[model samples]
Structures are given as structure tokens and as C-alpha cells.
Target: EENRKFVLRKFQILYNRVLWIRDIESTIVIVIIIRAGVYTFLLVIVAFYFSNKLPLCDNEMTVCRISIAEVV
Candidate 1:
């Protein structure tokens, strides 16, 4: 019947919308994870560069170690 077809079409639309939203959510999550990983990697590299460039003092070394730990 026409009514049954209309109902089926509506259900299909709703199902497709749900699936689209789920896909978008998963993509956002993946992007966020990648961004965080890259940020951490860059931070570590910067920390190493500074630690190497600066002459190590006891206090400065402790501070550098603490900062790196905080980043991790």
C-alpha cells in the first residue's frame, strides 16, 4: 500500500541520518586523537631541543624534567 511505502521511506531516511551522524562523530574523534598525538610529539621535540641547547644546572634540569613529565 502507499501508506506502507511512505512509512518505510521515512524509516530509511531516519536510519541513514543516524548512520551519517555516527560516521561524523567517529571522524571527529579520530581527528582529535591525531591532533593530540602530534601536539605531544612536537612538545617532546621542543623540550629536547631546549634541554640540549641550555647548559644544565641542577635546578634547571629538575625543572626541565618536570615539564617533560607534565607533557607526557
Candidate 2:
């Protein structure tokens, strides 16, 4: 029947729209998580390396460390 076909078409369109929105939301969340993880990892690595080096260096290294710290 015409009414039945129209209802089915409308449902299909709505279903597709929901699926598209869900996909976009999931993609955004994944990207954000990955970005945050990368930033945290890099920060920890730089901090650990520099902290260990600071105590073992001479006068020249002190200036270098200060510049590096400012850059970071």
C-alpha cells in the first residue's frame, strides 16, 4: 500500500541519518583521545630526560638547559 511504503521510506531515512551522526561523533572522540595521549607521552619523556640531565651538567649545560626549558 502507498501508506506502508511511505512509512518505510521515512524510517529508512531517519535510520541512515542516525548512523551518519553516530559515525561522526565516534570519529571525533577517537581523534581527541589520540591527540591527548600523544601530548602527554611527549611531555613526560621530555621532563624525565631533562630532569635527569640537569643535576649532572656543568656551567655551559646550565645555560643550555634554561634555553631548552623556555622552548619547551
Candidate 3:
């Protein structure tokens, strides 16, 4: 019947729209997770480089203190 055909067409359109929305949501979630991981990796590398620099700074500070003591 024509009425049945109309109903079927509407259902098919709704189903297609739902599928498209679900696919878009999944893609957005994946992109956000990938960005978070990349930023975390960059932060870890920066922290590692700064940690290596701290010991040299401490050594210099100690040398300065010793020189000041000798002068006094």
C-alpha cells in the first residue's frame, strides 16, 4: 500500500540520520583523546629537560657561596 511505503521511507531516513550522528560523535571523541596524549607527551619531555638543568644550577650556587665565604 502507499501508506505503508510512506511509513517505511520515513523510518529509513531516521535510521540513516541516527547512524550519521553516532559516527560523528565517535570521531570527535577520538580526536580529543589523541590531542590530550600528544600534549602530555610534550609536557613530559619539557620536564625532563628542566630536571637535567637543575643540578648544574645547584653546583654553581655552591661555588658562589664558597667564594663569598673566602672573601669574608
Which candidate achieves the best TM-score against the true structure? 2
List clash counts for every candidate, in order: 0, 0, 0
For each candidate in the order shown, give its overall lDDT on alpha carbons. Answer: 0.67, 0.65, 0.63
Q: What 10-residue stretch in candidate 3 is worst by lDDT?
A: 63-72
Q: Model 2, stretches more than 4 Å misplaced?
A: 36-72
Q: In model 3, how large is the Cα lDDT of residue 43? A: 46
The candidate, 2 or 3, that scores higher on lDDT is 2
Cα RMSD to the true fold for all candidates: 11.7, 13.9, 20.0
- The numbered model that scores best in lDDT is 1
22-62: candidate 3 lDDT, tens digit per residue: 99978965665565555545544675688854333234755
Q: After superposing candidate 1, which stretches have Cα over 4 Å from the reference?
A: 35-72
Which stretches in model 3 have alpha-carbon errors above 4 Å? Answer: 36-72
Which ranking of candidates, highest TM-score first?
Answer: 2, 3, 1
lDDT of 3 at 65: 39
Model 2 score (lDDT): 0.65
TM-score of 1: 0.41
